[model samples]
Target: MVTEASETNRDAGSVGDVAARIERLPISKWHIKVRIVLGMATFFDAFDALSLAYVLPVLIPLWTFTPAEIGLLISSGFAGQLVGALFFGWLAERFGRRPAVIACILVFSIMSLACAFAWNYSSLFVMRIVQGVGLGGEVPIAMTLINEICATKGRGRFVVLFELVFPIGLVAAALFGWWIVPTMGWQAMFVIGALPGLVCLVLHRFIPESPRWLANKGRRAQAVAALDAIEREVAGAGQTLPEISPMKVGADRHASFKDMFGPIYLRRTLVVWLLWFGTYLCNYSLTAWMPSIYRSIFHLPLEVSLRYSLITSIFGVIGGLACALTVDVFGRRKLFSFALLWSAVALLSLWWTGATSAETVLIGVTVSYLGITVLSNGLYLYTPELYPTRVRALAVSSATGWLRLASIIGPTAVGYIVAAGELKNVFLVFALVAALAGLVVMLFGTETKSRLLEDVSP
Candidate 1:
């Protein structure tokens, strides 16, 4: 839907007329409103994703959960997320992003209610798996949709700021869990998470479909209709629409999972998979298990454990904010390489000096969280940019399959490692993974700083 500054691209292949229209539109209040609608979906997705972690402390004692069982329960959601990512990616390409996202929200919110009503461990475990499917699918599809609408010049900060809500959701969960879980019950958190579903009704009314997606599907009239909607919004906000530039293009709507492994995209696909796996492995493991570590290993009060975990999440929000401000200037490639190494160093410090005290462990975890979470925020922006509109949702959602995998592995690994009284090894291993991913990215990653979507991928 955006620009390509490359003179070669200008001559090689046109970005098509619909994409040109999207590229020329100026930023306006309309953009902000659309972001809020989409951002709210991801906000609740984050809350529902982490809801299990906050509830685990209470459930551990309530149900007499072993560490192995704790890991299984945590990993179960991610296991479902993996499936959701692939299926929804296809659904987005086949049906449309709007319907796919709406369906995902419904699936998770309704299942979250079922989770609240779960009477036993087995029932909740199954419910989380179903919920995970929705959780995994919403984000990649949403990111692709946002990228489709965004102009290239400021797209990095625009999308990253929108994605920033994800971390905010984590913060809200931790803070609310600290308060709500102790007073009311853990089930209230799931009930609170279901609130995003209410917004789904009003969503299609506010935001238009991705015109780039429409045109790519060879539905020229629908693409023009969506662009007409966006223009009306911009006009209502007291702005004159600029004239669109010349564009001549051909459709490449046959994009599928196969193209991602072809010569053009294979390296990027591999590097992005590593980034997703390593980043989420480190991130989810720490967030999901830190409260349990504080409660069980350090003998902290339940409230205190949740509060410390909340602080760590706030640090992660700070990391994401820093990314939003600077990713445009410094570029995605350099930032990713540095942040991954930074995460490796922070976590490795804990292993090097002996992770003895709860306070020390919290400090190390917070520092590691700061560096690693930048990838969590920026990858949403970076991943979509790596592919064109034809395959953007498919590639991004499939990449998130790696995130779900890491999420599954990380928590399960923590449960067993902690169970074996070798907690420091957790940091040691995650650090190595981070370092390895950083190296792969530094060597192989392409710089997609301000280029238009068509130029980069096509």
Candidate 2:
């Protein structure tokens, strides 16, 4: 009895130590604040990305754009995203994260407002492409920032929570579009999309530059100052703090993008690149066509279909949070592989539902959406772990840029598929691709759990 009590006390002490360490991580508060801001930014992202989808139901009738022309407008932003990811990733390396992120916000905000003024399909398409650049730039840089600020143990939680903002944005879009598009018009949606960028501009001014980024850039004094401020913030709350050794990260000498593809990173690069392509393809396919798919199959009113979409978005957030809590415990490879396998099964069930009861269809779609949300959150966590500080943003952005290229193709291909009256068969393709993606990940991807951020690699 005495020995057992002693062991229990020791365990309690260890737990206390861990809690204190987590509390002392430089960016704990910053992470929370940034996620709140990211929620708003992601809301705009979803709003702008899907604004056309909402508008399409209204605009197709207004403008008489053929399926092909409508497809072009839908995909134009994705094309811009493809270019923007690469361009901004490169620029982030040169200009630092704070400037790059703010710049992207401004570019997208101004261009989205311009979209509301477009008189014709051609002008709207051009504006969308420009807006995509800003969209692409925002996420990759944000990911880079989050990865740098968060400690390794808290990484999965931080990344997953931040990622959840994206789907919430989509839900807000659906809600806004459902309410406003019918009352005011589709143009009002774009006007609404411009609001968050202004909010971002103001919020960003108060949030200091990332200490980790400063360290990675060899700005030791600034990094130390940032750390001191963080320590003061914690101390002000009357918390005991852990001692954090000051360490410089990244290269003193400038490194090129080619470094990402070198021998040390070759295997990691390949896995992350493929993972981005597969997961993005899955996410875009479902989100882009959700309203249309509901419309065609359920024959419901636009508002009712949108309500179901909003419900799914809610479930998506829940699913993301669940992943955030459990992913670090389970390991990225294991959780993601399971998410993929189940997503494939869910997609197959969705295909099966096309011939079954309405209730079954709803269940299937819900499962698939939930699974994909969990899987994508896993990728967001995994992608940043694969690269070192020197090339982290560039590596993540490179994969995302290519992934955006796939996103462009996924939605447009769906448009073509729908136009051909073969919408029912498309779920099968999604299932197969998801299955293959899982297999690839399971076979080739390295496990990353309980490892330091610097230790995660090919």
lDDT of the candidates, in the order given: 0.89, 0.71
TM-score: model 1 vs. ground truth: 0.96
The TM-score obtained by model 2 is: 0.88
Task: Please give each candidate's TM-score.
Answer: 0.96, 0.88
* Model 1 agreement with the true structure over 342-372: per-residue lDDT tens digits: 9999999999988998999999999999988
Worst 10 residues of 1 by lDDT: 1-10
Local accuracy of candidate 2 as per-residue lDDT tens digits, 1-458: 21222133332212122222333465445557766775566667767877777776777667887656766677788999998889898887777777777877877888889999999888998999999999888877877777666776677777877887777777778788788888898889898888767766665664566664565566655655555555566566655555533332323445468778888788878877877777778777667667666665557677766666667767777778778888988888877778888888988877776635335555666687777788766676777778766677788789888679778888777778768876656677888878887888888887877666655531
By TM-score, the best candidate is 1
- Which segments of candidate 2 are over 4 A away from where they belong? 1-27, 245-253, 296-299, 352-362
Error of 2 at 101 (Å): 0.7
